[model samples]
Target: MAKCDACGTTILFGGKRMGDQRYCNDTCAGQGVLLNRVRQIPDGDVVAFANQVHSGNCPKCSGQGPVDVRDSYQVWSAILFTRWKSTPHILCRRCGVKAQAGDLAISAVAGWWGFPWGLLMTPVQVGRNIWSMAVAHNPNQPSDALLRQARLILAQRSLQDGRSQG
Candidate 1:
């Protein structure tokens, strides 16, 4: 027997589950995702960034968003044994194209530079990143809550950039 996670109702039949989920219907599944996204946000800088986003300013560059939501996807193949991550921060319009380019560049360097492993891992990992970037979508007139999520991401990148520079 499964129980609806959202409403806590006992699910006698017609229940559904996806990735450790138990739900009575589609509506509950949607609610579960929203709640999960909120819960996944960690503390510390994200809290600070969320506050900043709720206000008028951008938490990242403070450059004001119309901001792009960058989604970085990582793939590791134990057989081919290559790990790659690529990031491209741009205006919402160009983010997709830039992400694709960055992924290809990173994958190629990791693969060819590494020789055998690069040849094996580069193709699949590059393909995965390309697909993800192609599907990436940033909402129009992003809500404050969504901006807060983006803020957390961008702030982390900024810190990384600073560390790498100095």
Candidate 2:
């Protein structure tokens, strides 16, 4: 059985095949293509690309100084099930701060009810969000994650162009 190139899930039935990679769905296929393209980009060029992306308007609010931020939260239910969620956003400092604050509140309120993992992970996730907020001292500078996101965006655009032409 072929495994999905993007998520490593086993392909139990028919799947999309691109070159040597197989994907279970269109989303996985798109992700796989973007990952492949990102791998091909040189590390030296990523920062430059990120700077270019930072200069553009935020996808969320059309504001300047857009940066890519991912905030995670945990939720526990029935003492046995734990859910960890990470949300990604491309926004200016004001919007990112608001989103992070909301996720942090949710995690703090509802993330510590399960057995061992919920207890352990809730603090970690909360701390990570706090640290992210504290360290964002400059709104104008693009973060490392923003750099990676920029690379992915470039790859996606290239892939789209290739698809349109082919």
Candidate 3:
């Protein structure tokens, strides 16, 4: 007898069992394996940037400005996935415009594919991004630690560049 990892069901009747499959069912198995995208990606800069931008601070210079907020997300999987989602973002008007342009550029590139999948996906994503930008004004200030880290990174890069040039 094995206990299902997800639902705590006692598995005593199924003969199609081999080894200790912590999850007693397929649904449980899928739920157990599927993870948050950010955690899966584990990119420090991406996470940090997301945090900074959504903090109601200017994303580029981290200064004060007329606040704007946008939420957009895209989910992509090689083998049948939801394909797109929503992400929240905050930025100044200038940064918002820049973000819109960048998103539009990405959508344009995808649209260039001009075929079944790309055609479908690009239009959907483009509309979503457009809406995200249009609705963008909304949060807390970023943590001091994050700001300090950015400053340190910039200082380190400048030091290395100076040394290399000299």
Candidate 3 global TM-score: 0.39
- Runs in model 1 with CA error above 4 Å? 1-65, 72-83, 86-91, 113-116, 141-166
In model 1, where is the ten-residue run with the lowest total lDDT? 50-59
Indicate the worst ten consecutive residues by lDDT in candidate 3.
33-42
Of the candidates shown, which would achieve the greatest lDDT relative to the real structure? 2
Decreasing lDDT order of the candidates: 2, 1, 3
Error of model 2, residue 161, in angstroms: 2.3
Badly placed stretches (over 4 Å) of model 3 are: 1-56, 65-69, 72-90, 138-166
Model 1, 1-166: lDDT tens digits are: 6788888989998877868988899988876665555455565556455444444343344544454445544333344455655544434435445656666666655555444666656786677667756764544454444556665465556555767999
Candidates in order have lDDT scores of 0.58, 0.77, 0.53
Give the runs in model 2 whose Cα sits over 4 Å from its true position: 1-30, 41-49, 66-72, 137-140
- Per-model TM-score, in order, reads 0.37, 0.71, 0.39
Q: Using TM-score as the measure, which candidate wins?
A: 2
lDDT of 2 by residue, 5-44 (tens): 8999999999999999899999999888789998887766
Whose lDDT is higher: candidate 1's or candidate 2's? 2
- The residue pairs in collision within model 1 are 111-118
